[model samples]
Target: LETVGYTLVVNPKTCVVCMDRPREVAFELCGHFVCCAPCANSLGHGVTPARCPLCRADASHQRVMRRAASLHVATMADDHMHPPPPPPPRPPPPPLPRPPPLRPRARTTSLGPTPPPLPPPRP
Candidate 1:
């Protein structure tokens, strides 16, 4: 059997304040992770003094951490476990028809535009 892959491991302890999805969350200068782009943007934009929720470090200087691939898998698993109701059936795929054979367009402007005259040098 083929292995699915390792689930992304998010450390709750490492998460300072936000409990939102790890994938959507970003780390502040203080190393505190906040959920959602709005939250992160709000914190960074001066609405709230960015600070690490856990360490109380200055969040203003913190850089956002890119979510690791492993974290993505874990997030997917969590979503699957608590999925919302499925949407209505999608429309059927359109029928595939053979594309018309390529015909090359006639080449115009074979020599291209004439070069402009050079300007005299300044004294």
Candidate 2:
């Protein structure tokens, strides 16, 4: 939430993936904050593997982001002792549309012998 006098908010750091939020979640292996916690949780979600956005290193130990008192941090976790609960699981993604059946190629029959290829001209 912005303050009463805060007309505009500009983040000094940005996630490479979202290009919006501050780069908060740092990967211990690469020592880079490729994205924030939400984005990191999002990247860590599902079967897909999470990797550092900058160096492409396999993100092992996710580190907490520490900012100066002046720097504004997004999300309730930054403020409250207990972070907000994860939103209800989203409905399973719609099933992928089945691909159309392939049609067999038509066969061509020639009664006469094929013509020979033309010779290339010398440069």
lDDT of 2 by residue, 79-119 (tens): 32232235679899999999999999978798778999989
TM accuracy, model 2: 0.43
Kindly give the stretch of ten consecutive residues in candidate 1 with the minimal lDDT sum: 76-85
For model 1, the superposed segments whose C-alpha errors exceed 4 Å read 1-16, 23-37, 44-48, 69-123
On residues 41-75, what C-alpha lDDT tens digit does candidate 1 reach at each position?
A: 56545466765444444555544445563365335
Clashes in each model (backbone N, CA, C under 3 Å)?
A: 6, 0
lDDT of 1 at 76: 43
Residue pairs of candidate 1 with colliding backbone atoms:
8-70, 8-74, 28-62, 29-62, 50-59, 51-59
Clash pairs (backbone) in predicted model 2: none
Q: Of the candidates shown, which would achieve the greatest lDDT relative to the real structure? A: 2
lDDT of 1 at 63: 49
Q: Per-candidate TM vs. native?
A: 0.30, 0.43
